[model samples]
Target: MYINLHNMQAIIALACGVLILIMPKLLNYIVALYLIILGVMGIVRF
Candidate 1:
């Protein structure tokens, strides 16, 4: 049961997209956080 953070983030981002379609309020924070995390991960080569 060794789940990586990147995989977890992707899953969360996907879920957030679905939630955003329903609520729409989560678009900003969820997408922002996902991009920030993915950017950091790309820069850090993780």
Candidate 2:
């Protein structure tokens, strides 16, 4: 039950990729949100 940032990012990215493949229209939002989240996580280091 202990996940590091890199692992979390990979999981999220994988989920997003699957979602994009299914929907195709959410590519922009998913990528943007992913970047924002990754940036925040990187800065906060939480």
Who wins the TM-score comparison? 2
For residue 32, what is the lDDT in candidate 2?
Answer: 94
Per-candidate count of clashing residue pairs (backbone under 3 Å): 0, 0
Error of 1 at 21 (Å): 2.6
Give the number of the best model, judged by lDDT.
2
Error of 2 at 13 (Å): 1.1
What does candidate 1's lDDT look like per residue over 7-45, in tens digits? 787678689979999989978887788789779989999
**TM-score versus the correct structure, for each prediction:** 0.58, 0.79
User: Lowest-lDDT window of 10 residues in candidate 1?
Assistant: 1-10
Alpha-carbon error at 15 in model 1, in Å?
A: 0.8
By how many angstroms RMSD does model 1 differ from the true structure? 2.6
What does candidate 2's lDDT look like per residue over 1-46, in tens digits? Answer: 8898778878998999899999999999998998898799778986
